[model samples]
Target: MSTPDAVPVSLAEIARIAGVGRAAVSNWRRRHDSFPIRIGGTDVSPQFSLAEVEQWLRDNGKLTDVGGREFLWPRFEALGSRDESGLAVAEAARRMRSPRTRSSHPGLSDRARDLAIEAAQLGRREGPRETFEFLLQRWLETHVRQLSTTPAQLASLMTRIALAVRLGASEGGLTVLDPACGTGHLPAAAAQEYDGEDLAVLACERDPALAALASARLGFVAEDRELRTEVATADALRADPFAGVRADIALCNPPFNERDWGYEELATDQRWAHGLPPRTEPELAWVQHLVSRLRPGGAAVVVLPPAVASRKAGRRIRGSLLRTGTLRAVVALPPGSAQPHSVSLQLWVLRAAPDNPAAASPGQDALFVDATRFARPGVREPGPDWDALGSFVLSAVETLDRPDSDPPEGTVRVPLLDLLDDEVDVTPGRYTAASAEPSGVELAASWGDLGTLLADLAGHAQHLSKLGFDAGTLQTTATVGDLVKAGALTLRAGQQPAESATPPREGAVPLLTVPDLLMDGKPSGLLCADSAHAVAQEGDVVVAGVVRAYKAWVHEGPPMALGPQLYALRVDPEKLDAHFLAGCLRAPANGRQAGTHASSSSRVDIRRLQVLRLPLDKQAAYAETFRRLRDFETLLTRTDSLGKRLVSDVSDRLAAGGLTV
Candidate 1:
């Protein structure tokens, strides 16, 4: 069936549905008198009636195979704010599922009702829960700018961790509570995981619109599987809708850095059983609130800012939490794992105080896990390595089972007393045994390995020195800009797209970034379908645009998306050798120029860097020599690292009487 006459679509959504760029949609709007006129939205991104736009596209033979859900998504968004769309959908869903119920949704438009019924029919055919999830996913993609929704993968991980904690406690028939559950992802994940089991999911969201959305999502899942779900629209901190109710498991990813989260009004609230939280530390308040909602020995897993583990302002509450045995484990996640993608975050697993407070020891050790490197590369959201993360969760469960067992690498058993020092820093990195000093046997082995590496290094150095080239006379120099003007190379910088842009799904082209160039000179950024900037070709020289330390590397991999803070230099083989250009780009003189330019703002203008002007044959000849020098330098670095380890190992072994000098 055709879209409703009343529903409108934004230009961006129209482009997406038509399998073309937004510019194409704009061109159509301006060039074709038959194109739909604007009905709503701002002048920059005006909306057009869906029926009119679809008719125009069909008339022009530009129509594509857009899905029913895809066609309705923009219309739903055009209804109003996300909350309005959510409410309309929720009412429609309720009516669709229970047609016999009294009609109270007088606000729902006739067009919205028709679209919702069509959407619900599609849902029923595709399995109601899956279809609803698809609609919700599309809605989330559009409102990503408006909502801080958790990534699906992260939500799954959080739910898995909560379940593991529940299993560790030998709990069944799970009752899960998410106090600050935005859109109810955590609770919904729990419902799915515990399918066919008697699971009760409860959640609270301060935003009424978000609460309605969450309620709709959880209600759909509950209806599909006959699970128990309850959601309320109330501030979880100031007016906890589920107060005095204790659950077996409580999961939360509360809002961070909320300076005025009703601190003055709720200062004397009883939920702060441990201690009052400072105005600056709202995460602590969330932790305590979630803890208060857990029954005795009930487990709660909370996503918190990394600073909470070490921030001095919250030190007293941290100490109280550690001393009271409420805090059980602290896990450090990789950067980009949570919102504020640049900052690495922490997950705190807490247990409610036992009924007899005296019986609960005040100094029990807590598990500290350093999974800081566990996230996979992502374009928009940090994609976690599920296998690694799952392994960590399982290992944590096993550790709880065997308290006396030695924790694995990246995991430690740190005493509460140790964490209660001056800093009261519970950062897992501080206490992890992964950084422990090597033993005598390990030291001796390192020494042995160093000797073998030294011999290999000497052989490579000898070979490099033997392939000698003549020291040429002083040559004329030209900046990269001159070479560009002479058709020797084309230099272009990568663009930095907005953070809200949708990341490419898995298996797309990988993106090369500055960090990747600096670390090992590889394309390590998340894959993206459209980079919206210059892409790196295999023969191109990718230079780090941020000149904190000048770096240049030949792009040897397949052509991929290029990220910000990088320059892609495509060389004309007939004019200049790529390797030679890379070598000159890495020269100290160019590095000095980069440093000078970067001194003001750390941004380097690569075009201004100087290079030695030489014939193609001369460039190739010098390139080979420079290549060998690079190999020599690599071996030298390895040799120096090994030598330091060897010396330290020998000294350590001698002190322990395990080896003779």
Candidate 2:
């Protein structure tokens, strides 16, 4: 068995542990003679003893409290498969439950006991809630192939709809149910809706380990509220734990298209009040189960695959649900809503139906909202616009309750009788028109802006074509380190800002980050008034300290605070020009020399960067040329953005009959 100190760490791991860039780590190795010697790997990427690096950090006041779970996670993952890690997390939660208890859980193997002890120590340092959440989140990430979690956006939206219709019940305020609560995100969302009210959560999960985690998650998130949690480990369909307890509000995101959902043995299950769900329609079974658990006047939200709305095997059940007004709205969510991101999923919001058949509303209409239209265009990452999509679906549901209100675009309310045909298809996209034609005024304005952008781009291209470069004018160069020693320039490294500081209100200073520097340093972040970090001046040159991603430019925007992986070079006006120095650093030869290793993505050493030695009058000529190049680059980006938008706009207008040819 290898001890925790015997573990090896790479240079990249050391930087992550210290919460700084690799350049800072390299600087430490050069300055401190007591640094750990390389014990493994090649010269380009060396490995060192974990224990030695940790001691050096403590002696130099760089490390505090084992770096909070970073040290333990590697050892924990080394335990074995994901199930082993999950058991360790469960045992850690048990240890948290009893502060004085240190005994190993009978479920964990002898190999995992050491990891559980390390996790307990972490729990003591950081609060148990935070440490436990971090461990559980990592565990889920590692096991994404076997499990899936509902997005917080979907959870909150479903919870809010339940809250709107939930009536006062059972002196205990409201009872919320999650029939398939994976990690308790849905139930937690419901718990957060009402803090002062007496609450009770009834959750069920097939996996015992996950059931324990869901219970602990709720315990942490519930805080000081009067909350009672009844989480059962058995499958909800096989054995109903809270069958007699009808809930006032409920939300669930169930596993879709499962074949072995007890269709044969439980052929006459009483929960299937609508009809017996077919072998291939497990999502429909979950829907009926959740709906059955609701009180006479209660409501529940369930997420299902799009096929359930129109599957040939489930058409009878779909029609029965529509005829009784049990399924009120079918909302088509955009891709990336759940595991199978290639296909769009549907959210079925179910309301309690009457017991007698005659009491069902005969003339009621069902709302079909096409939220697939809310997917934003030109986004590289796959995910719906949660804020806009959620608002659209929730508002469409709100419109259903008020018959006088007009339905919004991408939404339609059809008569339930029209949907009671032989097919009984309730797909939202089939009934609702997703895209609407744009007005003539909007189309005209877009065309005019596109023409202006194209003209400006052409002008910039012509200006850049006339400038000629002479390679014979090269001069002797001095390293940035040598220039600093001679009092010609000053170099300052940026610090990592707290992530809690997001974009602030008006009057706050913008923070110049590495990404911002790459895109001309236009301040993509913010630093509040109380912050005391150093700010870059107008004439200072900022450079990104990363190889293969080199970017350098003179600061021309408002005075801004510096972010990590960035360096500011403040030059002496008598000796150097900011634009000239930036252009020198931007050269490919200088970038190759500044990089510390052979790898293309190595961190840069600013001291190794070189600048040309020229007279003040001679430098002014080069500075003017560099300034023009910067303008051409900025104009090129603007032109590319406008060109893409015009292409999309023109195609859309042509399809909608707003444009001819």
Report the number of the highest-TM-score candidate: 2
**Candidate 2: Cα lDDT at 587:** 83
> After superposition on all CA atoms, what RMSD does each candidate show versus the true structure?
7.2, 6.1
What lDDT score belongs to each candidate, Candidate 1 first?
Answer: 0.75, 0.78
Instruction: Please write out the lDDT profile of model 2 over residues 135-157, one tens digit for every residue.
Output: 88767866888897887777888
lDDT of 1 by residue, 366-470 (tens): 888888778655333355665777687558645753666767778888777778888989988887743555776877787777788778778777877577455
For each candidate in turn, the TM-score is: 0.71, 0.72
Please give the range of 10 consecutive residues that has the lowest summed lDDT in model 1: 495-504
